[model samples]
Target: MSQNLLIVGAGEFADIAYEYFTVDSPYTVVGFAVEKDYLTEDEKFGLPVVALEDSVTRFDPAKTEAHVAITSTQLNRVRERLIKKTQDCGYTLANFISPRAMVWRTAKLGVNVFIFENNVVQHGVQIGDGCVLWSGNHVGHQSVIGDYCFLSSHVVISGYCKIGARCFLGVNSTLADSVTIGADIFVGMAAVINKSFEDAGLILNGHPAEASRVSAYRYFKLKAPT
Candidate 1:
């Protein structure tokens, strides 16, 4: 495994990723990269901040792997797009599963996933690519979290639950067993989902969650689920 890592993004998430990867993982923080337009800072954490377009030329992708460390901007679309761009730059995407996390042996995670400490991933769980699970979440047995989803800290997704792609689960939210959420859904903070929702682009909130009048897509300024 490559020890050098090029983090894509110079913002807060990038800073957080840099710290976690440097102190907790085997990979060393080599540099930071962002789109040319957003390249304002000269460096981050004493490392060079290069333009993402010139990253491959500056940092050899063969020796330096990359991680797209953007938060759930644009309902995870921005992060997803950046991940693709990094892939186009010929850098192999790296996943960081914190050693403090209690991930069951039967749990499977896809590429570019960022899982923080104190997460309990039960058996038969399948987490998709580009997903971000913040600290202290509980992903129960046989649950499936889809691609590009963001699970905020302390979420409890019970067993057999299925969350669709690009969903943003707010902090302290709890999904009861067998709950199914559709793509582009936004589960609000501290909300509790007890049933199933198959409709995409819905805003689910409130205790014992209810769909909001505003569409998740509309609130996110997206015309539809991408």
Candidate 2:
């Protein structure tokens, strides 16, 4: 029997999550939910769209699970906030691990993870809650990815590396072995990280990635909603 799932958000990521979970996982997506103010449609993907505040009552948290399908927008703060909100509503979060992902049996993953196709999570890897590993990424042995991190396509996390909470590793970025990345760091596309960075809230870029003067909020254009 498939478990019922209520996917939060009605954006592109939510649609992608719906497709992945429907085709690859054991969860059956029964509905979509978003903040009432953000809702513009009554239905999506043929599922009834409900306000997230009322989703618990409509979906029955005891029988249904939820997956927050928001992207790493706003330095991942938006996704993190919704994740916490859903958890507080008594819905256990669901993980969507693709059947095509080569996750070693020794790897540990927390709830609400979305690991896409061809992700190679090697032995002894620890992926924390609400992390999203896009397709074709490589997580090397014994690496630790902290909570709510977003690893984009083709990112390579070398062995024994520690990526801190709420970090965003862009496509094709490479982390050297044994490096420790501080919390809320943004590693830009194709950046090669060869050393440990302890400072948080940095926007790192370039071939050998260096901290940019721009904040993530400014670089990513993440302004508070008006």
Best by TM-score: 1
Residue 92 in candidate 2, Cα distance off native in Å? 0.7
Q: Which whole-number lDDT from 0 to 100 does residue 71 have in model 1?
A: 96
Off by over 4 Å in 1: none
Mind sharing the TM-score for model 1?
0.96
Q: After TM-score superposition, what is the CA distance of residue 132 in candidate 2 from its true location, in Å?
A: 0.4
| Candidate 2 lDDT, 165-221, residue by residue in tens | 889998899999999998778888889999888645464567678887776556667
- State residue 60's C-alpha deviation in candidate 2, in Å: 0.2
| TM-scores for every candidate against the unseen true structure | 0.96, 0.94
RMSD of each: 1.4, 2.6
Q: For candidate 1, write residues 81-185 as lDDT tens digits.
A: 999999999999999999999999999999899999999999999999999999999999999999999999999999999999989999899999999999888
Model 2 gets an lDDT of 0.90
Total clashing residue pairs per candidate?
0, 0
